[model samples]
Target: MIYIPKMIFHGNPLSFGQYFYDVWGGVSYWFTSALSVAQILLAALFLSQRDRMTFYVGTCTLLSLLGIYLRNTLPSPFPWYYQTGMVSTLLMSLGGVYLRYESRINKLVSKPYVFGIAAFVYLSYVMITNPAHPQGTTPDICMYLWKYLTILCSIICIIALSHLLPQAKWLEYIGKNSLIFYFFSGTMLALFGSITSLLAPDTSYILTLTVTSIALLAATGIN
Candidate 1:
C-alpha cells in the first residue's frame, strides 16, 4: 500500500546500495570480487566442522562494525550495499549453519521446519501483495521467481545443514540479527542517498562514490 515498486525493474528504493549503483552508473559492480570472497568465506565457515560458528560470528560482527564506520568516514559510492551485503551474507550463512546444527530430537517441533514454514509464508505474502499485475515491467515475474528460488534454496540449505551439524548457538544469534540488520541497513542507505543527492547535486558520480566510501570506512573504524 506504500506504493512500493517491484524489485526487479524499478528496484527497491529502500535498498540504498542498489539505488546508488543505479544512479552512479553501476560503480559498485567492481566490488563484486571482494563480495565474492566474503561470501565464500562465510559459506565455508558454515560447512566446516571446526569452531565455525565462533569464527563466523566474529567475522560478521567485525564486518558490521566496519560497515558502520565506513558509512561515517569513507567516501563510498555505495556504502549501503556493501554493508547490507556483508551483514546479509553473514546472517544467511549463520542461518544455514544453525539449520544444520540445532537440536530437534528433544523438541516437539524442529526449528528448521518452523523457519522454513515462516519463510514460505512470507514469500507467499510478498507475491500476493505485489501491486504489479501480469507482465508489468515494474515487477517482472522472473524477479519474483528468483526471490522465491533464493529463499527456497536458503531454507533447504538450512534444513540440510541442521541435519548434519546438530548444535550452533552462534548461528541462531546471527539469524536473529539478520532481519533487523536488513531493515535498518535499507533505511540507512535511503537516508544517505537522499542526503548526498541534496548536498552534492553537482558532484560527479566518481567523486561522490569515493567520498562516500571514505566516509563509510572512517565511520566503521571509529565505531
Candidate 2:
C-alpha cells in the first residue's frame, strides 16, 4: 500500500516482493545484531560478573576499532547493511550491556548528568579535532574515528536527555507505535513531499520542509 505512491508519482516499477526484500534486507543487520546479543545474554547467565564485564568490554573495543578500520579501508558505496552494520550493532550492543551492568553496580549511574557530561566531552573533542571531511567520503582517519565514536556518544546523550526531560503523552504515544513509524517512515516522507508540492507549490522551501516534517510526524502518530 505504501508503495502505491511511489508507483504513481515516481513510476517505480518494483514489485511488492522486490520492495519488501530491498527494505527488509536493509534491516538484516539488526537481526544479526539481535542474534549475537541473544547469544551473549545466554552466555552471561553462566559467566561470573568479572568474566561478563571483560567479555563485553573486549567485544565493544574490538568492534569499534574494526568499524573504524573498515570505514577507512572499504571503498565508497560499500555495503553498509552487511559490512558496517555488524560492526555498529555489535559495538552498540556490547556497550549497552556494559552500561546496564555498571548501572546496576553504581548508584551514580541513575543520575543523567553522568552520561550527559561524558557525551558532551566526547562530542566536544570530536568537533575540536576532526572538523572537516569531503562531501561523500571519510578519507581522513580522524573523521572515521570521530564518526563512529560520536554515534555512541550521541546515543548516550539522547538517553540522558530522555531521562532529564519531563515525560509527554505524545512522545509516549509515538514510542508505543515506534515499529509502525519506522516501517512507514520512508514512504510517508515521500508521500508528504508530493502532497506538499501539490497543495502549496508556491510555498518557500523552508515552509515546505516544516510542513513535510509535521505531516510525517502526524502520519506516524496516526498510524
Candidate 3:
C-alpha cells in the first residue's frame, strides 16, 4: 500500500533509498499496520473477556478515534479510504468477534429470508442515496451508521446463505482452500498489472478489473 502510493502515485524519490527511509517516508504505513495489530489484540481481548466486551469495544474504538481527533488527522486521497475506514473497520472487527460468540443474535438473524431480505433492502437504500464517501475532509455521521448496520447485515446474510447455499460444493472448496489463495494473490496481481502495462497501458477499466479478478482466482487455485 505505502509502496504503491509512493512509487506509482507520488513517485517518491526515496522509494529505493535505505530501508529506514522507506518506512519514515510515511506514517500511513505505521498507522495501518498498527490498526491491524490492534484488531488482533481486540479480538483476543473480546474472546477472553466476553463479559466486558462493551467496555473493550468502546475503549478500543474511542482510543483509535481520539488519536485522530487530538492530532487533527488529515484525510487520505482517492483510492485510500483510511480516514473513515479506520473507525468503520474496527467496528466491523468488533462485530465479527461479537458474532462469533453470541449465538442468540446469530439465531435471531439466521432466520430464513429475514437477513437475506434485510441485507438486500439495506444495500439498495445505500445505492439510492449517493452518500458521499466518508473518508473525506468532513465526515458524515450517517456513513458511520451505514457501516455499522451494513456489517451486521453482512453477517446475517452469511448465516442465511449457509442454510440456503450449502449444496454448492465449489463454495465449500474455496472456503477450505482460502488461506493459500490469500497468501499468493497480491504478488500475482502485481505481476499481472506489470505485464498489462507493458503490453497495453490504456486497457479499459472494466477489462483491467476483470483480468485482475480472474488472475486472483487463478492464483488461488494453484497448488
Candidate 4:
C-alpha cells in the first residue's frame, strides 16, 4: 500500500486506479474493505466466545460459509480459496464442527484405516468424474461438493493420523512453529519470484523451489 502512491503494483493487488490486464487484477475497493472488516469481526467473535459452546459453533458455521462466499466472488485468476477471510472462517467452522462432535468422531477416526479409506474414496470419485473447467466455480453441484470434500477429507486424514501416531517432541515443536513458518513462506515466495528469475532458466525453477522449501523448513525448524 505504501508503494501505491508511486503507482507501483506487483501482480496488481487491489488499489485505487491501478489495474492490470488480468481480470484478477481489478477489485472493488468497497467490497474488499467491507469483507475484510466483517471477517476480522467474525474471527474475534470466534476467539472470544470460546467458552460458550453454542456461540462458538454458530460463529464457526458463519465463518466457514463466509469463506465459501469469499472464494466464489474473488477476481478471476486468483487462487481459489486464496483469501484469508474465507480461510479463517473455513478453519473456524471446521474447528467448531470437530469440537462439537469430537467424542463421536474420535470413535470413528481412531482407526487410521478410516482415513486411508476416505482419502482413497475421495481421489477415486474425483478421477472418475473428471470435469473440465477453469480454476473457478461451476454451476454443477458436484463441483462445490468436491471442494467441500477435498478440504474436509484432508483435515480428517490429518486428525486421524495425528491420533494414530505416537506422541513425539519433534512433532510438537513443528506444530508450535507452524504459524511462523506459514507467514514466512508467503513472504519468501514473493521474494523468490524476483530473485530466481536472475538464474538460468534450465535450473532456476528447481533450485528456487528447493531453496524455498528449505528456507521454509529452516524457519519452522528454528522458530
Give one digit per residue, the lDDT tens place, for model 4 in 1-223: 2234223225545543343322233232323433454466666775675666667556655655655666667634232223544445555555666777899998887776888877886787566556763354557345655666776777777887788789999778768866566545545555554556566445656787776876666566547
| lDDT leader | 2
Instruction: Report per-prediction Cα RMSD to one decimal.
Output: 18.4, 5.9, 6.2, 6.9
lDDT of 3 by residue, 1-223 (tens): 3255334544445434543444443333444444454555566666766675566667667755653553344554222223433454456656656666878766777776677677886786567555764434436545555655676677677766676664777667767876656545655666677777888878798868976887767765684
Which structure is stronger by TM-score: 1 or 2? 2
Better of 1 and 2 by lDDT: 2
- How much lDDT does each candidate structure score? 0.52, 0.60, 0.59, 0.58
The C-alpha local distance difference test score for the whole of candidate 4 amounts to 0.58
What is the lDDT, from 0 to 100, of the residue 24 in candidate 2?
Answer: 51
Give the distance in Å from residue 197's predicted Cα in candidate 4 to where it truly belongs.
Answer: 11
TM-score, every prediction: 0.30, 0.58, 0.55, 0.54
lDDT of 1 by residue, 109-171 (tens): 245675566567656656765778454453433453455455655555455556677668856
Residues 102-204, model 2: lDDT tens digits: 6662445446677877678686866665548334453566675666667666666666667678989989987887766765666776777777778878868
Show pairs that collide, candidate 3: none
lDDT of 1 at 20: 48
lDDT of 2 at 63: 57
